[model samples]
Target: MNERLRFVDPTALMHLSRGLTFNPLRSAEVLDDVLAAFDEKNGYVSDVQAWVRGGGLQNGPCPTLPSGRIVADVTETMNAERKVLHAAAILKLEREAGIAPGVFLSMVSPTLDVGMRVELPMRALLKGNLPLEGTYTVYLHVLMTSDGRDLVYYGITKRGWSLRFQEHTRSAISRESHRLFARTLRDLTAARARELHGVLDERPKLRGLITTICATGLCHGEALDVEEAMVEKYSLASKHANGLNMIPGGAAGLRAAQRFKGTH
Candidate 1:
């Protein structure tokens, strides 16, 4: 198990990633034994198990997550490509995933349609171990245009999305966080030569800013897992060159979650 990260075997970690569904309990048990062996407390011992189960903190340009739209605001359109599926249609998806009815959340928007037609099912069953329901939320901070080329920031929170958005908002508005999300906001604010509040109010009206909910009902571990996957999928890391995230999702999000919710 310890060999998973060994530099000697580069393929070990890749093998882990390629395989879907990790046994968190198994990973946790192994890590516990390893940690006990060296009495290591502040290192990977504390986080590896969680990483194996879940994954990032993205206060992304989303860190500047301004007030944005939700399901209720969706403008039903005749276009079939962007429509959010109704719960009745989602019933089969929910039951197949073994989640309680209505727990698999799906959001809609013409800007960047997020209904079951797209990634709704992808997040839920990333790994066979993923639960259909839990507390934490895995979300995307999106900025898109009519071209639909959107830039995104990903983050997870047990806190209501509003409260967490405020945390990023406060940090970015003050220019305290240098993370990509904050930078994106500051850059936009600077570009318009306008006050932050005014810019926040303007972006959505122009249909350029969007806050997306990927999925809810994730337990701490599952949320982290999905967040990491989102970061990777969206290319949020700097190397991806298109994402607004400076840090990969999971560890940071997991650490924050541990602080707020404890390692239960």
Candidate 2:
């Protein structure tokens, strides 16, 4: 109901659609409160219901036999909860067992290391988290400095962190760069270009300055869930505006991850 509610069943009040984005917290049976008040008097056949009725569909058996009827069909739905109480419970128990939380993102204290080994600690990310293994990792590109850190962008990746970092660096220098990390580097470089007399160097300037805060213990679906939550929390108003995200988190991540998985 937080977004928009449209259906004529008067009882098929699904909170969010199941097709657009998968809400891990949801299952079909948890949809509605039948006891909740519904205004039937104001309820009239919607455009969808009218279309079905126009087709002269009858509420017979089989699909209608034992009072079975299809009122409407919607394709896209998504939802998120901030409390994450249920997931938190399980993660805390995992922590007790010396396993890492399957969903988490936070900045690490800068090791202040320089040269080639500078990214080693950040690549491993959070310390004290065992079992740094998962198909998908939800990560944050944090702009780190001696003063403090700021979130630059968020993403999910199936490739190992080290490989993904290299992929991003390569993508940034490619002529037709459309990758998220590449785009972010382009944006940052452009900003710097203004001061450097219009020199748009797309080299990986962020190599040492960026620290990745990652959640490395979630399965594919769980990773999508956490990615969806992280993106919503730090979504850009416009592409390259506040962040480099061009799409909403959950559903899109699945498609991208699938493609990455196939390729690698």
Highest TM-score: give the candidate number. 1
Off by over 4 Å in 1: 1-134, 145-149, 193-207, 252-264
Q: lDDT by residue for model 1 over 83-163, one digit each (tens)?
A: 322221212332234321111222343322333211222222222223333367776766553334566788887655546
Overall lDDT per candidate, in order of appearance: 0.44, 0.38
Give the per-residue lDDT digits (tens) of candidate 2, residues 3-122: 222221211111111111223222121211210111142222232233334432233211111222221111122126432211111111322332221212112112222212111111
Residue 252 of model 1 has an lDDT of 65
How does model 2 fare in lDDT? 0.38
CA shift of 204, model 2, Å = 14
Best by lDDT: 1
